[model samples]
Structure formats: structure tokens, C-alpha cells
Target: MSTSRRTPVTTGLVTALVGFTSSFAVVLAGLRAVGASDTEAASGLLVLCVTQAVGMIVLSWRYRLPITLAWSTPGAAMLAGAAATDGGWPAAVGAFVVTGLLVLATAGWPALGRLVARIPQPVAHAMLAGVLLPLCVAPVRALVTSPWLVAPVVLTWLVLLRRAPRWAVPAAFAMTMVVVGIWLARHGDALDGPLLPHLALTAPTLEWQAVVGIALPLYVVTMAAQNVPGVAVMASYGFTVPWRAAMATTGIGTVVGAPGGGHAINLAAITAAMTAGPEAGPERERRWIAAQTAGWAYLVIALGSTALATVVVAAPAGVVEAVAGLALIGTLGAALHGAVTAEGPREPAVVTFVVAASGVAVAGIGAAFWALVAGVVVHAVVVRRASGADAADEDAATSPSPTPGR
Candidate 1:
């Protein structure tokens, strides 16, 4: 095959490989945190893979653009940090459904999209950073507790970070697999039950707390961290994403997969560049083929979801979390930078970050929801005072009395 044809195929596979291996653990941790059983978490993983695959295939083929979909990684981090809801797994599933509907509504209602866009960027980033804090420290915690298992994984990640930056998380995960294999060998008969992929669906039951605590925060995070950035990434590569179509596809996919434990799906932010950029091919028109190829590749990866979950089930404590932490370290850094660097909202952003990282639940609601509330309140007060001060200064300068006094 010629280089043009091969590039799309190869890059498509790489994009899928890197995207899936790098963060699937985070998805599992999120589902588990929100009260999913091991089987249910595995089901979530499998269905998320299928839903995103379909979304990518349909969006790319229809638009003739390199548009790939992914599970909302930042939203997952929020889930990992969230306090379990009063209604348990069913409530979490309900929250997932609500998040999907909100995404769909955002596509249908221009005002809704505008409302989301109005959120201060610093506050949003601070919320994400706060949610990621505990997870990002897992490698350090794991190293302190289980150096034998975690040391090699961290070393592998560090070495790869300097050389092949894109492959760092995947390589660390590969090393973790080696550690899991060793653990299994030492403890024979560790494997149990079914290893093949299967769905374990939950009937969603809406609870007010879940809606307020999980669904609302989840919708905001998915929109701000994944969908918006994904559009920007594609645009940076000279591809204009069809916003409504993209949201409709991802929203519908999220709704369909909710019963199977998938949290949410949205545009691929990190992998979008790989699929849409010049790396896919010199011919811009043909890059859509790379996303289509990646869609098919995800189906192949889905076959291993159950086996991967099985290892996670049997692996030593903190091992999977260590990998998850390493995968998120870069994202945490980016979120923190975005949180602190905004000129006007810096103080309010810090307040948001501190509140979120506190992990304090109030009246059955998680800290994430409260963090946004507190940040917005502080922002309002600060901005109001600043504007008032500016107006007073302007009035004083223009006043006739000041000229008479001089």
C-alpha cells in the first residue's frame, strides 16, 4: 500500500489504541465509585466502547470529517471523586441518562449552549482540577504502599514521557499488565467466573440528589472539558465540526448506553488531533477515513473489555489506580494551569479548587456541585465590586467639583 493509504490506517489504529489504553481504567474507577458492581463496570466499559465507536463512525462518514468520539474522561474523574448517591447504582444510571438529555437539549436549544458557554473558564477548570487531585496522587500513594508493583510502572511512564510523550500512559498501563500477570501467577486460581464480554444492565431510577449532584456536574464537565476542547482541536486542524450533529450523536449514544453503566460519551479531545491533523495524511479530504478506521478499531478493542476488567478485579490494591493516576497526571496539570492563570477569576478559581478537593458532601450533594456554586457566588461579588470601583473612579475624574477644588 502507498504511504497515503497506510498513514490513515496506521494512525487510525494508533489513535484508537492510545485513546483506549490510556484511560479505560479511569472509566472503570468512575463506574465503580458511583456504585457499580464489578460486572456492571465491565459492562459499562464494553458499551462505552461500542457507543463511541458508532458515534465516531456515523459522524465521520456523514460529515466527511475526522471526528472521533470518546468517553468523557474528565467527567469520569469527577465520578471517581464523587460521593456515592443515596439511590445507589440505579440513581447513577439515571444521572447518566439526564446528562445525555442535557447534551441533546444543548444541541436543540441555542440558549442552553450559550448558558454553558457563560460559565467562567477558570471556575470550570478549577472544578476539574479539584476532582482530579486525589486520583492524580494515586501513583505516589501506590509507590509508598506497594513499591514492588508500582515502581516499574512509574519508571516506565517517566522514561516514556521524555521520549514518546503520547505513548507514556499506554506504556505505563502495559507495565501494569505485566505486574498483574505476575500477581496472578503467584496466586494461582485467582481468576474466576466469566471472562468474556457481557452486558449487565441497570434500571435507572431518578433521584433528586443524583440529578443535582451527579447529572448536573457531569453535564457541565463533559461539555466544558471534552466537547468544547474537541471542537477546538478539530478546528485547529482546519476541520469544522458539525456541532449539532456531534451533540445529537453523542447524546443519543450516552442515553442508549446508560442502562449498561456507561457514564457519558463526547467528542475526542486528545485523540482528535491524531485523527484529524496532518499526521493522518497530507490530503485533508481523506482524513475522515482515519476516524472511520478508528471506529472499527474500537470494536476490536471492545472484545477485550471483559478480560481487562477481570484483571482489574483480581489485581492487587492500588495497582490499577496507579495506572489511572499516571494517565491523569498530565490532564491534572493542564486543568490546574487553566484554573490559576485566568486574570480576573483567579481568586474565585482558587476557592473552587479548594472546595472541590475537600471532597465535602453537603445535604447528599457532592463537593463538585457546591464548588461551582461557591465559585460563581464569589465571582459575582468580586466582579460587582471591581466594576463599582471602576465606575466610581471614572465619575471622580469627570466631576466638575474636582476641577473647581484644584
Candidate 2:
């Protein structure tokens, strides 16, 4: 192949590796939060990670856009909430299908897509910040229970993040493994387990209650709270791709992976932005190939679920938390700046961010959806009134015939 083609392909592989490594901790946490049995959760995550990688590759290749696919982090939170109400794996999958359909529908309708696009940047940023705040807090909360285990790891992560942002995660993981190994050795914990691989397949079962109660809500949260912003992030990076096609790719991936208990697959915004940015490559156009490489690498990970989960489980919790938090610092700061910097929209954006971070759930919907609703109402009332007043003044000035007659 020519030098130009080879460069994208190489950069694409590197992007995938970096993206997957950075985000894997979050994925593992999502699985555990939802109470998946060790084996089942491992299998499900394997499916999710692989399918996402594949979808990213296919879509990037097709559009020649630097679009990277990832499992929905916010969607995982919705599933965690649903699981709290006794929704099982089947229910989560059901929710995935519902959300996939919603995304598909949104993409199919040009008017709706336009409406989604028209949401103010401040509002979108607020929503993104709101959705991510909980994730940042999860590790801190974990620290309360396991300070001995979590503290050293977290501190190491912070220092590494400050000194070497790119290597922070991997460094934290290494430190965590060392800590765990030492602790295990001191306590004489058994390290013996089947070091062999096992394969288990789960067939999809339809559950009506799960569909309505769990699946629908999850679908809505994933698409609205997660995927929409994902598209916006891509656009911000100067890559404009079709949302409909991307959603369709996720839907099809969900369908394909459903039998193995995968929930949903979608575009990754924050993490993708990290890899597709100047950090990953010298040339802009080569970024798409990075996403493509990530997709294939994800498939390799899926095939090795047992080994991967074991590694994740073995890592100290603090290490994962601190690294995830640190990696997200830049993203969080950007979201906050966007949310609060706008002159007229700051109040509404603040409201959205607070409501989203409150972790409040009413009628089974998450804070992300509610935040958008609240912000829009405020924007409409405030912005429309100002617009109306301006229109009235213009009308008064232009009323020539009445004055002339008088």
C-alpha cells in the first residue's frame, strides 16, 4: 500500500488501543454496577466492546470520517438504575433495542434531526456534564469504604495524570496490580484459578415488562443523553458524519450481539475525541482509520473476555477510579466552561447541570433527559420573551400610516 494509506491504518490501530485501554475501566464498572454475574457480565462486556470496535471500523471506513464507536456510558448508568428495580440482563437488552430504535427513528426524520441539532451548545454541554458527574463521583465514593486500598492508587493516578496524561491510566493500572499483588501475598490470598478460557453463550429472551419499564428508558437516555452529544463532539472536531447511518450501525450491532447478551452499541464522544484529536495523529484525515483500528482490536478483546475481566478485577479499585477521573478532567472542565460561559443561557445551563448531577429519578427517567427539558423550558421562556419585545419595538417604529392620518 501507498504511504498515505499506510499512515491512516497505522494511526487507526494506535487510536483503538489507546481508546479501549482508557475506557475499559468505566465499562467494567458499568457491568459490576448492574450486578452481572462474573461470567455473564464478562461475556456481555466482551460482546459490547467487540461490537463497538467493529461498528467504529465499518462506519469510519464507509464514510471516511474519523468516527469512533463505543459502548454508551450513560446508557450503562440507565441500565444500572433499571437493574436496581430488579431488571435482569434480558431487561437491559430489551432497553438496548428500544433505545436503538429511538436513535434510528431520530436519524430517519430530517426534521427531528434538525431540531436536535438546534439545541443550544450551552444546553448540550450542560447535559454532557450532568451525565458524567456521577461517574466522576463513583470512585470517590468507593474510597470511603476501601481507603487503604484506594488511597495510594488514587494519589498515584493524580500525580501521573499531572505529569503524564497519556500514560496516566496505564501507569495507574500497573501500580494497582503491584498493590494488589503485595496485599494478596501478605494476606496469603489464593491466586489459584483456572487459567484456561471458557466460552458461554446466552440466547436472547423477550420480556415485556423489561421492554416497557427498563428498555424504553435506557434507550431514551442512551440516545438523548449520550449519542446526541457524541455527534456534537465529532462535529466540533471538524468531522461531519450522518447520525442516521451511525445510529443504524449501532442498531444492527445490537441485533447481532443480542444473542450473547450485549445491551447497546453507540458512538463514543469524549473518548473518541481524545483519540481523534491531535494527540493520536499528525494528520486530521487519518483519524478515521484510528477508529477503524479500534473496532478490530475490540473484537480481539471480546474473544478474550475471561482474561480481560480477570485483569480488571485484579486491579485495585482506586487505581481505576483515579485514572478515569483524571482522564476525564479535561472533558469535565470543557463541559463546565460551555455550560456556564454563555451570557444569557448560564442560569438554565446551571439548572440542567444540577438536576442531572442530583441523581434524581422520576417516572423512571434519568437526569439527562430532565436536564434537557428544564434547560429548554428556561431558554424558550427567556429567549422568546426578549425576541417578542424586540419585534414589538420594530412594529411600533414602522407604523407610518396611523401617524400620517392623525
Winner by lDDT: 1
What's the C-alpha lDDT at position 325 in model 1?
95
For candidate 2, lDDT tens digit of each residue in 1-406?
8665666666656555666566556665655554455566666677787778778878888887778877766555444433333455555555556656656676677675566657776877776677667677756876787888777767777787789776676666666667777876787776442233444465544565556545554565465555777788887888786777887888788767655556677777766676567654667877777677767777776666566566556554555565565445566677788788888747778787887677666564545566777887888887988899999999999987565555
Pick the TM-score winner: 1
Per-residue CA lDDT of candidate 1, range 1-406, in tens?
8999899989999999999999999999999999999999999999999999999999889989999999999999999999999999999999999999999998899899999888898999999999999999889999999999999999999999999999999999999999999988987847764589999989999999999999999999999999999999999988899999999999999999999999999999999999999999999999999999999999999999888998888889999999999999989999999998878748889999999999999988999999999988998999999999999999989987745555
lDDT score of residue 307 within candidate 1? 89
* lDDT for position 162 in model 2: 86
Q: In model 1, which runs have C-alpha deviations exceeding 4 angstroms?
A: 401-406
> CA shift at 283, candidate 2, in angstroms?
6.9
**Per-prediction TM-score:** 0.98, 0.76
